[model samples]
Target: MSYPFGCIVVGSGHAGCCAALSAVEAGCQRVLVVEKGPKEWAGGNGYFTAGAHRTVHGGLRDLLPIVQNVTPAAVATIDMEPYSSEAFTTDIMRLGGGKSDPEMVSAVVGGSRDAVKWLAEWVHVPFILSFNRQAYLVNGRQKFWGGMVLSVEGGGKGLIAAHQQALEREGVDVWYETPAVELILEDGHVTGVVVLRNGQRIWLRASAVILACGGFESSPELRAKHLGSDWSRAKVRGTPYNTGDGLLLAQFAGAQLTGDFAHCHSTCWDANAPDDRGDRELSNQFTKSGYPLGLMLNAQGHRFVDEGEDFRNYTYAKFGREILHQPGGYAFQVWDSQTIKWLREEEYGDDVVKKIWANDVAQLADNLISEGLEDREAFINTIAAYNAAVQASQRERREVRWDPAIKDGLSTQSSQQFLALPKSNWALTLEQQPFLAVKVACGITFTFGGLAIDPETAGVISASSGEPIPGLFCAGELTGGIFFGNYPGGSGLTAGAVFGRKAGREAAKLAEDIYN
Candidate 1:
């Protein structure tokens, strides 16, 4: 421990693990990883994730070899469309509203497939086809929609366990409860880190330091300062350990800030969940994305956004803000028996969230009134009007079917008429018996602002000089400009892998050159 290490990585999340692993792979010896949280709270935002990792692939055939869950027999029963680099790039640009850095987006999109492969093959992250979250059985085949199709086995916990095993195998020493206080710079170059452990300050000298400690989403002060006053009300969907330490470290080192600081990725979390932080046991189960299968109503008994504007993965992030803007900063997702079964059990099962049940529309509204539905009559009228619109649209299409696996064109609008707030697709009547509703609030996942980084080496860019800072690199949520307002689902982890590897490999090369 007395000798100067080759590289030091901050944070112990998936990105940190990837960085440390890559540094070792690039022939760096004695790499150290320092984490802010205790050993029990290891994985940062990654542990709270569903472990879904989006990447470009050539359909089922290309994915079969990497995934462990799908059997040979099951392969024939799967329908997965190939996701090309072009499609991945377009998704990032489109979701980010054309504000994303095209070069950074290219770096991620281009490396996505290789990153996934390395995670599975090298890191031993058990990859699986996301049947529960991303696929639905249609015509006796599991149809994968959206651009997301892969996930780590057993979700986030499994993902972290795999990384831990990999790190141990690579002989990397990870220090838990060692919160990095500041970056140490000498002659305008980052040389090491100052961390506090058990209230004692200690300096660790290394040739290169990589910041992978995530964003400022958990800090309400930072959230309000950047994302506006109302964003403080959004629930912290991941680890409370992030708290902007990486941002501060970079800022103090004169690193340039980039991306939209005012926006973030969020989702519809269960209203009954703890206000300040996410539950470790429930993890991502607190999400209530069933709106795509039914309707989302506010306290005023009115449908707000189009529920089926796109696949759930594409629309879920931005919709959380819409829910937060609703009356009382919450809303309700309602579904009848027909589409109720379509809701992911992990999210809507009785154990996950409170389910209000009623046999008829009026009774349903009456029941929801207790849960903050303001107008029972308006709620009933809304359902009645929605049902009427669906019937009218159905009549216009004749034999149109409801398919959750595709954009089946079963919307609440016909060629000649439309509802004021139309369900774009998967439109179904809410007249079936045993209607159910679940209360939901906004859950802030991660922020989109951090230090601007060099696309190839993941080096933090200097604010004053507009050049890469010597010995300073970054990855994961701590690095910015690949995203702006929003990002495609599963892209977060992929971007982490893409840039984390770059940061680690390049940091090792710098370390070798300096120490030699």
Candidate 2:
């Protein structure tokens, strides 16, 4: 039986889910959610996320005062204190290399606190509380990525399930295992969707359509064609379902696209190689031995950017650069037995950090030699020189670490903490045995660039004239330029939620007001 709906939301990920929820809440009587995968594989980027959700006001607004009082020296304080909105904005702009749009950034920053509060109060999600009895904010003031997940209890699964239940409660129809093959357009407005269900093409009618499909990290051709060659070389860490189908469909319908040059979390595992099992084995090695925990070198044995910066900077640093030119694009973590012991103790309970291998310098060297990933003598010599530099710098009170160039070719902070160790002590030293070197190939989770949209309503805009396409909307990674070059914490999910809600509510209003 064919079905008609007031609105059709493609992709049941965080964006689509939020859009449906908002539509139902806004008094839409008929809404359908079409998801490509089954319930077991429902989550898009929201599932694998580290769960950091940063917002500027509302529940997270209390962090603004703390960030305001922090000095440059205090930025290094690792008490996991809350940060301020101004400081968070500054960091986001810096990370984006000042290419961010002020209006969009301000909108995200301004809406963040309210969004988090809504998620907790209305959505029944439980936010992580701070030691001082407030919601846990990153650096003490801003919301962390995983905060939303903690608020929901069962993490991404819980959040998704809750939304699904809400949709069902509102009588929203959800079609699982139904992938939208194309957008049905009539007279230049989206009329419905042509989906593949049970090996049959089903034409689902809707007054309006919302595209919440994710980015194209899973498609090498899209990456090579849309993004530059450097981004194409990186590995994918997100879901394999994002093959640019929604993007292609929208573009085919004459929708304008933007933000083809943005990406997030460039660090990836060499899971492409048959020899590598996954990130787990490598993580276990890193935790046990404390190796491969410092600055990365290219294949040529020279240090790249500062290893202590966020992984985003590290990923951009390696793009198009010769791995050999920068210390072979992979380097060893040289630490003594004390450091190794400390790391094991510190990271013992954490599953995320347990992937690192902690080993003495010499032992690490031998491990690499045995693995045939490096030459024994050169590896040893490199560690020795690194140790010498670290020692000399410590004595002279000078920064001796190698800092990689980030976007716009600016060097990151020289002194940053990593592996729960001070930057200075984290430097390579030759005195330690079991020196560890793990070959790391640059990896990326997802590309952030996609179609441009109106900041106020999440309506797709014409790339050539910057005008809105009525009756058409986009959310999630499909809507680009929202994050600029770098993303504000939780902007991905937050944008999806905020904009998806707007699109759904607005689309429903437009549908209800349509003249016969």
Scored by lDDT, the top model is 1
Report the lDDT tens digits of candidate 1 across residue range 13-129: 989999999999999988999999899888888998999999999998898888999887898899889999999999999989999999899999999999999998999999999
* Per-residue alpha-carbon lDDT of candidate 2 for residues 296-353, written as tens digits (9 for 90 to 100): 4333334444443342321232332233123323333334543443333322334333
Error of 2 at 324 (Å): 12
Q: TM-scores of the models, in the given order?
A: 0.98, 0.75
Cα deviation of 164 in candidate 2 (Å)? 3.2
Give candidate 1 misplaced runs (Cα > 4 Å): 1-3
Q: Against the correct fold, how does model 1 do in TM-score?
A: 0.98
